[model samples]
Target: MTATSVGALLLCRADPEAVRPPAHLLRERMLLLPAGTGWSVLVPEGKPWRGEPHDGPDAAPAAPAAPGGAEPVDRVMGGWATALAVGATWPVIALWWDGDRSGYTLAAGFRRPVGYVWLADGTPAGEDEAMRTFAARLSLDPVLDVQELEALTRQDPEADADARLRELLAVLTRAGVALPPGLAPGEPADRLRTAAGVHPQVERIEWAGWRDAVQVELDAVESTGLGPWVRGPRARALAAAQVAAGIPLTLWGARRRGAGWLAAGLVLLVQGALGLAYDRFRAEAERGARGGGPVW
Candidate 1:
């Protein structure tokens, strides 16, 4: 693929409605659209990786720097995938390609992300075990899907990086992923954004400040009947954990100026804060019901 074809797509194994709330927490402009039965695709409007180098104190020591200090496409997408999947039930698969390489990073829950890469010429550059892990995480057909994924890791003279990505998507079709027309792999980031913007069902996501974001998240949780998990000591402990994890992570991201980690840390902090607030609110309401006093 040409350098100009640098682009990435975040495929979430969830409906757009479920993906919207956490997506807003990313604080980046993106276009969301349904992919298939239970899949959604997020096309980022800005290419932050192409911008100024993240040399801040929070910058990740291992983050690879591209020419002019820009973060590599894979690194940026991988971070974003992790951010999106951290507190959500569904997994996020980030498919990214640049002039020199192409790969996919799959992040689910708090587990370590797993991925495989290929050179621009389609030579596999990752471990074979990664494919097995990928298939297992997605719950794809153990024998059939594993065989197909393994094929992508083998040498293929006719396939280029773009072709490899396409083949990977082909295997995912069985798991209900049908990308919209013109949203194909290897397209330029601007073009991908344009394509996503045109879809009739596309929804634009932007940073709307913490107040709005927290409200949306709370509404989502309530509507999804997740309130039970938002109250009680267990929930409070989880919130505390999130806050504890987020502080250091946010600090690290700030120091390094890494968007992915920053987003992740912010998400954790917000979610933790929300959890604490919700728990308190519910407790007061119950107390008021028992004639203790007004909740407010």
Candidate 2:
């Protein structure tokens, strides 16, 4: 699948404390746009997918974070459809950060399929609709045939591919879904099977929320650095993410809620353009404060 299939895009923040959604707010539609059939699954690192630093693994699959802060590591998250057969070869995965996990690899049946972003049927159920529906009930765990997927994660020395079949069989048994061995995984074991749907795009939006919060915090640190004309580590990092996403920082600025203290956008107006004006304004204000100049 195209790297763009599972693209991770982000915009910069002006206020570190400001709240915003990572994905564009559905200003119009109340549904999640189907991303596409190219399945892009990501396993984020760090505590609960907070935006991590610049130099690190992109997909660190550690436990969720606690109240205390810690550095986040990276892990892999994107890929596309593969044949359902037993042995699959290396699939193509595009990379943005530095690491081997950023690319694709040869794995088992569930390594990553071309994701179909829609309701179970062929219809567009945007993030909002998905979330609304999932909030009550959604299908995510359909007794996956894990033998192939587990094989991708590690070596399996089983005599039969039936191990996966057994796992799925066990899950169905527990869910009270009775079916014959002849039934396919996708074929409904029962009428209620299709009732539950998975909303991946909604999950991605939540992930973006965590990132937005992180960016807002980073924005505060960078804003302070800007006044001194130094490149704060966080600012440099934000710029790098922009570059990777193939979007201009300026467009992200447009997504900010309110301007800076001076009503400047996400990144303040470049000092090159506003520095002298700022200094002159500061001088006049200082002079007036000292009662040594006209208060124009």
Candidate 3:
């Protein structure tokens, strides 16, 4: 009836697209297993899921498995990762073709079970009888039981949800990710700043903080070359104007105007070059973090 923490955590990945298996369905499947070690994953032989419009090789959902299909690589994936990723609702049984074949076995880390009918070798067996025994224990959720994902995705794209979504993304953006009104579609940022709005000062603070982060990121990019590509001419003009207005390098009389133009042009070019260098530097930094330094 109750799944352990890890089981629940992993199960939570299920999104509520009608085609995707519901969480309770997976739970019911797991409850049938007789206290065992090992985790679960999905695999496919020559065919795809029972009934599908597209029966092509990659059309049906399947999990990552070993050559002989014995050991599974990741536990988070069951049935087919593709199905879950695309929001299919079928309960995929992890099946292994057989041992002594040329492929390797998909093994698990012995994490808590969540209705995985172990694929001993590419075969789907009801040998794990506890699953059938607990079938009656499963209950269907009510319509109101819309999960968090459903709630998160329910609103119209151009509605408030999109705005909130933008702000949420804006909040989580890596420090230095810029957010001028140009990047986003609406003037919601300005509107949200008024004291009368439902979320007064919400977008205002977010925009302010976002701007600060953007500047830091820009400075880094300008020093290096990783700036974002913005579209609006107004935004670009504003940036250039800001550059031109700042203490101009003026000589005297006619030379003053020329000096301002020269200073602005140099600043613009320097800013652009820095952005290019930064993109390269940031990419390299990410690679180093993931690859654990150089190979050579």
lDDT agreement with native, every candidate = 0.87, 0.28, 0.28
Candidate 3: worst-modelled 10 consecutive residues by lDDT: 1-10
Ranking by TM-score: 1, 3, 2
Choose 2 or 3, whichever is better by TM-score.
Answer: 3
Per-residue lDDT over 18-94 for candidate 2, one digit per residue giving the tens place of the 0 to 100 score: 21222212111111222223222221211222233223233234444435553322222222112211222223221
Among residues 3 or more apart in sequence or in different chains, the pairs in candidate 1 whose N, CA or C atoms overlap within 3 Å are 56-255, 57-255, 57-256, 58-252, 58-255, 58-256, 59-255, 59-256
Looking at candidate 2, what is the lDDT of residue 93? 20
Candidate 1: regions farther than 4 A off: 1-3, 51-69, 225-296
TM-score per candidate, in order? 0.71, 0.17, 0.19
lDDT of 1 by residue, 1-296 (tens): 23466889999999998999999999999999999989999999988775222233422233455466767778888998999999799999999886667789999999999998887789898889999999999999999999999999999999998999999999999999999998988898999999999999999999978866876776577666565567778789999999999999999999999999999999999999998998888677658858967544
Comparing 1 and 2 by lDDT, which wins?
1
Which candidate should be chosen as best, given lDDT against the real structure? Answer: 1
lDDT of 3 by residue, 98-143 (tens): 1111011111223222332222122222223333221212221223
lDDT of 2: 0.28
Off by over 4 Å in 3: 1-65, 68-143, 146-229, 247-296
Provide the RMSD of all predictions against the true structure, rounded to 1 decimal. 14.6, 22.9, 23.2
How far is 202's C-alpha from truth in model 3 (Å)?
38
